[model samples]
Target: MKKIIVSILLIFFIVGCGLKQTIKDTAQDLTNNTVALIDDAIDEITHESESWQATLQELSDNLTDEAQSTIRNEVQNLATRTIAAAGSEIRCNVDFLGARVVQALQRIKAELLNKPIPQRNPAICQVIPTAIDMNLTPNRRNKVDISGYDFDNQPLKLYLITNDNQRTDVTHAINRLSHYHLVLNLGSNGVLLNETSSRLVLEYKDSQMSSIAITQPVTPDCKEEEISFSPDIITYMPTHTRGDRDYGGHGPAITARVNIYVDNNTIKAKIYMRARETKSDWSTADGSGVFTIYTAPSKRRILTIVSDKETSTNYIDSGHAEDFFEKGSGELVKRFAFVGDTDGDEAGTRTRVKVTFNRVVVKLKEIGNCKE
Candidate 1:
């Protein structure tokens, strides 16, 4: 544009000189001609300027659109990258890049309008892509287990990434909602999972966008079906089972598993404990009892176990006790068990006791019609 303006000025200067030399006799006419020439030059320059500006403005508009599209896609990808690994520093870098792009966009517009470019944003723009990695296979019904996630009433979205790096937004229908899981009906859409890892984007009503990154895939020894309990009962039925040998004989050689069920009212517990002998076949005991949980500190009879075979603390006829410390509602109920070798039954055959509880954690529930 500057070059064009300079060229126009040179042509006007040459034309004025020629007109002055040609009409030496007609001074008044020469003056009129010179003035006309100047006017013509000025008009031509004005028209050219407008045209040039329009072109620049058009270019700037196109470039701005391109830059915006590029930046948005790049930021999305950057956020996805952070999911497998993310932190504050990485976000800062991404924000810096975005700011630079924004600055570049402003410069493009400034050039188009022949104006000064504005300063970039001082703060880094964060693009939090809290994405969840959903693994699935083709022709399968998969429900993302959000049991490990500690969020409720959160809105969620799903995204499907194409092979060409295009992200397609997908919607999900809730099949079932439970305390430990969210069963989503993928329908025939799961066929897309045949290629890529299912990516579920979750966000809350008053929160930023969240990808399903909060869950760490863990393979538990025993996986119970997802169940729904009361809101106060944040947890449902949890089971725990463990069995191993005590090399130093610090404890007994034992194998046990316990299943605890909790709801809005009372807690029912089923426990199985056994005393095993490394050498000979020994008697084993099985017990199922009820735990009494109330606001008071009463030490009443809370347990009754029917044993298949009974054995003592030291292979004698000693039994276990039922005692616990229950806090207020919606809290953990704990029991301290000190099962030691009260009877020195190891004299005959080296043996130990094994215990397994469904879970160490017991979630308190609402007391609605609870069997007080």
Candidate 2:
């Protein structure tokens, strides 16, 4: 029975993998809003069965007629085979199959969007390709680097989960070359310090989850800093834009607002970004993540911020920026920018986007002990 199940799964897995790549390639041609719409339609299908066909039609509108027909046929055929296989030894219903198929499709969609996925069973983990000969070591600048085969080729998220299940995002720390590698800058604000136990987690395509225990402690030079900013909310608008195409220019202007909270050595930011490609079309990028803020004068502030996976939309990726006190306003400000290669590099359709930060209202400021 297990063999049968595995065999059936293998068949579906192959199909799913192929379909995943095809859909992802197709998605590259779609605008961000269009892709979000398709994603919402898929989300709708998972919950309601009666209107799936109609929703599927909406999805098909963006795809080629041939591709749409092929997807429809594939779904029907896969459903039929699942039912046939179930009849021999088990029971299956359309509702169950519908839910499962939608879940699988959603997973694929998440991967394409470079978003994190919900936790599922370990069996599903087998299909995801993993790193080989991987070695992770602490490097200078309060960062860690993981190197090995197949390490940095695709979009992935990394985290440091403490024993109590607190997760810290460290995904923006990567070196993107012909052969990808990781350069994790775990800031010196002692955010990663004092964890009783922690492990580095990696989430890749299809939510392939892999983890390595942090057997060796990372005891960076410690320090405490007193920093407080007011208005609690800072609004960021695009200060400059350079790309083959302009984002949020077609309809609404793109904007990001961050609600910030400061603790001893860490900064908690709830970030919300409105990425509107057009007036009638828009999608949100929102999530909360922590930042390790190291004070100046040996307090190195490396602003690599990633959001919480569970609550953030996949579109709201990590922000790589700098945090500093504005010389004139004395406001604690964060400046960051991101790039969008709406089309591949060979096509030369790259957009280097920049956004502006508002003046910070500093209420309190202090520096704590710095240990070497």
Top TM-score prediction, candidate number = 2
Q: Give one digit per residue, the lDDT tens place, for model 1 in 294-370.
A: 22112222122221112122222233322222332332222223242234333223332232222232223222222
Instruction: For model 2, give the RMSD to the true fold.
Output: 37.7
Q: What is the C-alpha local distance difference test score of each model?
A: 0.34, 0.42
Query: Candidate 2 local accuracy as lDDT?
Result: 0.42
Lowest-sum lDDT 10-residue window in model 2: 124-133
Across 71-164, the per-residue lDDT of candidate 2 in tens digits comes to 4445444344434433423333445545554664565456446578544332111211132111343233254444322342466676767778
The residue ranges of model 1 lying beyond 4 angstroms of the native Cα positions read 1-141, 148-152, 163-165, 187-191, 194-198, 205-372
Candidate 2 residue pairs that clash: 143-184, 243-351, 251-278, 251-279
Runs in model 2 lying further than 4 Å from the true structure: 1-34, 50-62, 65-89, 116-372
Best by lDDT: 2
